[model samples]
Target: MKLLCLSNGHGEDVIAVQIIKALYQQTDQIEVVALPIVGEGIAYQKSRIPIIAPVKKMPSGGFVYMEARELWRDLQGGLVGLTLAQLKAVQRWGKQGGMILAVGDIVPLLFAWLSQTNYVFVGTAKSEYYLQDEVGWLPQTSFLQRKLGSVYLPWERCLMKNRRCLGVFPRDSLTTHQLQQFGVRAHDFGNPMMDGLFPEVPIVEEREEARSLRILLLPGSRSPEAERNWELILEAVESIIAREKKRRLCFLSAIAPSLDLNPFCERLQAQGWQQNTTNSLSTPVQDKQGLEFQKGVTRLLLTQTAYHSCLLSADLAVAMAGTATEQFVGLGKPVITFPGEGPQYTPAFAEAQTRLLGASVILVKKPSQAATVLHELFSDPDRLQLIADNGKRRMGEAGASSQIAEYLVNQI
Candidate 1:
């Protein structure tokens, strides 16, 4: 079969890769073609397939301007430039005799609908319920989401009604149910994309050899909130270092290419802090799947690389509320999530964060509360261990990737 995977952001790219890999694993005879949103196209290269990017030449700028123009062109031309990229790429692979399958992004869904091609929609693009529901860092007005709601909803509903449509859900079995509400045939598949990166157990490091406690502080992947969260968490870490002399601290660095953290690192350096030199350490039982950290000051650690390494090494994590918390729970590690004063971390999200992780995630209302909680958790090892044990039970096993793949394959 010929598969056309479409992704918009870095998160979707990770999902697309897992879906493609799973499809190939089931049937090696398939040919895959990836068409990603302009700047977010690198992850699919590893699928060993012919990949094309539609937005490759488009200048990265205002979403309202770009999306409006693209949507208008699509209405007139049957497909936009990026959609044409998918069409052309799929056409090239079809010549070799295979079917086209889509993974994520709404633009490609528009093209696939126009082309009458069979496709699967993965991640969050076509799911209207998610937009109405899922909480993120962006405000509704800030991203033109409120303005584009009318255009996007109708387009999404029409696409969802198609018999060839398939959708993936991250949290619930709502994908198929929600699509069915719009007169579409859909099915729930476990989220296979979550299986992207798993850390391996590391050889016992010297610090760990002495059985010293290691803690991780994850502010986030973006600099705007990360800087503030890092400062808050650093104060808590300082308190821990002072009280518990045996423990070591590691900051899971977020290095978004669009943002720099050099100034922040320099600031931390002035406070007598240094980057972690020790590698990630998972237990003997998890040795086969743990990730190892490489020593370097120059290379910006990819979000997944840094996160997976830190989760494995540290006994516990203090993080800002977001996807990282979800990842920690999946890894059977309890994390303390604090949503700062921002639209992203509203009161509703604070509640949802706690509910989603059960007891594995603890939410802090203020920076001062954070310091108090960390101090308590550090002082009481039994309480910390109990949280970790509870996390392991609540999250279950780590096979979401394969399950998600199987669901996508069955959709076609």
Candidate 2:
């Protein structure tokens, strides 16, 4: 079997490879091809499979204003420029041989219909409502948004209806139900993106573990949101540290490579929280003068890292609501979700998240309230333990990747 995998960024590309790798592991007769949908990132080169359809250089310099909302619109406006390029790649490969597998992007859906290849669209978005509700913060909006939301609804419905595509979702029961409503055939396999999240590290001699309580802090991944997130989270961290001096705080900088971090770090200093750069992979500089928190409060910055490894090492996580929240829950760690002010955390988004997780996770209405919740959670260690226990129960077991891979294999 010759397979063509459609992938976007490194995360999705990694997922594409995992499925292909698993297929190869199962059968040596398998022949694979890769067709990257987004920028020509290192993931394309890192792919061991053949790249019969190489990524084309997208037209550059689509100007986006620095304002968050406007920036998002500008980014979305540029999608058309690459359509022809992507279509050509798909046409060339579709004529050759193989089935298609799309990973969280629309290109595969469009290409599959045009090429008439049996394919599966991994259901990253449960409904048009799902993205609007869960990830409204991104530049894109749902078919329900005031401007672009309704406009795209007819088009989206048409694509899904005609494609005869199978929808694959992360083994979340609620999300699978939503997909069914859209008239697309849906399947739930554990989220393979979270596979191999934790590697067992042998505990050796009496080496002091890094921190008593390793708290993972994920601000939004974009730059505009990062500034606001840094400010809001620092305030909460201050309050938490003051009340509970024994605990240590850690920040995970998962910002995209396109942006800079100094400005955000400087803002942290303004809030009386010094940069603990030593632990961050994204930033190597060390700050000698650590910010003064409550007597026992220490902050460490974890630079760019495999998030799963971080989750594996963490006791608890406070994440700005997004996909990371799900990953934290999958690791059996309780995550506190704050729908911070912005398009991302609107009232609609919060409700959808609550429904999906069945109240297994924590939702904070305001950033100001985070410290109070954290304090309450810390005060009752049993409650935190319950959260962790419940998280694993809700997220289910690992190996979702293998299950999803099997579904894709059947699609061919």
Candidate 3:
């Protein structure tokens, strides 16, 4: 049997890769091919999956719906032509008479449906929680929206109910129940988003005695925006240090593989942070692998290695990201975020994330406000604990990848 995996966006690609890995483990008889609708599908390529569709990095970062400007920019970048080509590929591939696994929102699901293929829909994007009465204040659809259908529109419900759809997996149980009420065969096995996270024990010898608070900084993977976020976060950290001179704070910045560290180093220098040149490459701190910098009593370690361990070691996180933020929260860590003038991390995005995570993530208006909140949250350990617990509850547990793969194999 042959399986064609359709995924859209960065997060979707990651989820698709995990499922692909599990699928490979299940049987060698099945051949797998992937079609990533947005971005470069770098994760899929890294995992050595056979990519068969046209892929591009749009100006909107695959979120054209978020802003009109992003949509226009993507349109100018041949979005229409690209999408049409990808649709054609799906149609040609579908004729092979196998299975299709759609790993994103309406686009991939629609493509699979149009191709007349037996498919499984893993709805990774929308959730009923966004439109629930309890979270109605957070930007959402109308209150009169169908409780038994998708949060956005009726089209998804129609697709999910289609006869060709072999299985429908939702990100959470609430969504699964909602879809089931709408007469769609939906189930929430678990969230594949939480899969592949292995916690690492921090090295005791590398711990600094003067470091009172350890904070993780995630500036996202996209360029320019990542740099901008880093600047804002560094400014906020500076403010925190200026206010509290007695306690020393350590900052760990997780650099994505796609980003260049030179710009980040320049930004740090522009902000009056000095690189610590004393530690040689052979030292323990250097062996841990990171570029170290200092500003007053605050120390910043920028690293590209052991990213998850950095998150595990942190007391809190100041993240301006999408999937990374959720992953950080899933590890039971509280996060602080400041909205950026973005095609991605806008105020609306922040509000939606806050609602999704249930107060595990706090959104601040500006850098100064972020500093204030950070100080307050650090002082209140009980509040921090509450947020951590909330995060673990909201993000769900790991091991969903293997379960999802098993379901795909059995259903197909």
Task: Find the 10 residues in a row with the least total lDDT in model 1.
Answer: 293-302
lDDT of each: 0.53, 0.57, 0.81
Top candidate when judged by TM-score against the true structure: 3
Deviation from native of the Cα of residue 373 in model 1, angstroms: 2.0
lDDT of predicted model 2: 0.57
**Best-performing candidate as measured by lDDT:** 3
Candidate 2's residue-wise lDDT over 1-412, tens digit each? 8777776655567677777767766667667777666555446577666665545433321112224565556346555555566777777777875777777545556776676666666644343333332334224433345453322254654666565555545345444555466664666665665676652222122226544556667775555665677677666666666666655454443443444667666765566655433432221112222221122246455344344445566666767755666667766676666665544544556566654454356777765676677777778878767666655655556676667667666666
Report the number of backbone clashes for model 1: 12
Off by over 4 Å in 2: 8-10, 38-42, 48-77, 105-107, 127-170, 175-185, 199-211, 246-259, 271-297, 341-352, 379-386, 393-396, 407-411
Clashing pairs in 3: none
TM-score of candidate 3 on Cα atoms, chains taken together? 0.91
lDDT of 3 by residue, 1-412 (tens): 8898899988899899999888889988888889999998888898888888788998888889998888999999999999999999999999988999999899999999998989999888877667652334434555566443457467788888899998888877767877887888887787889887654324333447644577888998888888888888887777777776777677878888788999999989998888888754311223255788887767788887757667767778889998889889888888989898776888889888887777788888887777788778878989988887777766666877888899888977
| Stretches > 4 Å off in candidate 3 | 133-141, 146-152, 199-211, 278-289
Worst 10 residues of 3 by lDDT: 279-288
The estimated TM-scores of all candidates read 0.64, 0.71, 0.91
Error of 3 at 412 (Å): 2.1
